[model samples]
Target: MSLKTALRVIAWLLLAGLIFVTLSPIDLRPVSPAPVQLERAAALALIGFVFALAYPRHIWLVALVVLGSTVLLELLQLLSPSRHGRLIDVAVKLTGGGIGIAAGWLLWRWRPQR
Candidate 1:
């Protein structure tokens, strides 16, 4: 498969996993007992990184997609008996996403220009 196709597949899979983890009632063991906000931020950062790699030419669009999905998922959490949405979490997610986008952009810029 082509590189673009592979990236797209990875991005989608990451997104699916993100959604499942975020909404699931079961608590998966985290690497550490970090605060929930940190966990959310870290997860989002990875999501943003994958998304940026998947659509490197449209960085702003990727940001919008990431932010939008974050908002949508947070809202959906209200329906989950085990979860509730929080504005702070959204803010942290955005911050983490920004970091991811910046990292991805730097990597993209350093790549050999064909």
Candidate 2:
């Protein structure tokens, strides 16, 4: 597949993961261990970073997409009887998304043009 196609596929997958991490009620409960959560957050951020790098021309769009998803999920949590939103959770998601975007920018900044 072409680079653009691959990037788009990755972008969609990242978004899907973001949705899963935030919206899915089944596994949304806080895990017993904090380390696992942090590790998962880090991975999510790394994925965001890679996608941001692949689509740097739309950085703000990417940020909005990432942040927007977080907000949307939080809203959903508020609506759900079993779930409520937490500031710390939002902060964690934002941190992960920001890290991913920054990491992608740094990694791709010096690469030669195609």
Candidate 3:
């Protein structure tokens, strides 16, 4: 498969993992070295980076997906007895996503010209 296609697949996989992690019971989640908000930010940032690479021409769409997913996942968390949605987490996620998007743009720009 072309590199772009492979990257897209990887990006989707990452997204699926993110969803699973986001909705999982708090007690069942793996221990992290950082606070929950920081962890969430880091995960979303990585997600945004992969997605941006997968859709370089659609940066806005990538942004929407990252931010939208952040909100969607947090909302879904409301249904989990062990998880509660928080607006602060969403803000952190957005900040991380923006950072990732910027990184992706830089990567795309740095690619060798055909």
Candidate 4:
């Protein structure tokens, strides 16, 4: 598969995984060696980075979608008995995703045009 296609697949998979983990029972959530907040940030950041790379020409749209997704995912936690959404969590996720998006945008800018 082309790079863009591969990235798109990865991005979507990440999003699906996020949905599963966010909405599933607390016991079903994955454990990470990193701090909880860091793990959350890294996951969203990776999602944002892959998305930005996959659709470099639509970075702005991708940013909006990913950022929105971050908040929406957090908010969805409210529906789960074991999960609760918080503004601080959303803020952290947005920060991470923004950082990743900016990094991806810079990399795309630095690449030599074909």
TM-score each candidate.
0.85, 0.78, 0.91, 0.95
Clashes of 4: 0
Question: Lowest summed-lDDT stretch of 10 residues in model 2?
Answer: 25-34
Q: Which ten-residue region of model 1 has the weakest summed lDDT?
A: 24-33
In candidate 3, which residue ranges exceed 4 Å CA deviation? none
Residue 77's lDDT within candidate 1 is 89
Lowest lDDT 10-mer window, candidate 3?
A: 28-37
Candidate 2, residues 59-109, lDDT tens digits: the string is: 888788776777677778787666678878778777887888877777777
lDDT of 3 by residue, 1-114 (tens): 998999899889988998888899887777777997788778888989988899999999988888898899989999999998888888898899899888997899899999
- Judging by lDDT, tell me the better candidate of 1 and 3: 3
lDDT of each: 0.82, 0.73, 0.88, 0.90
lDDT of 4 by residue, 71-94 (tens): 898889998889999999999999
Q: Which tens-of-lDDT digit does each residue in 1-114 have in candidate 1? A: 988789879878877888888788846524568887788788788888878888999999988888788899889989988888888888998898788877776787788987
> Ranking under lDDT, best-scoring first?
4, 3, 1, 2
Candidate 2: clashing residue pairs, number: 1
Candidate 2: the clashing residue pairs are: 49-100
Which candidate leads in TM-score? Answer: 4
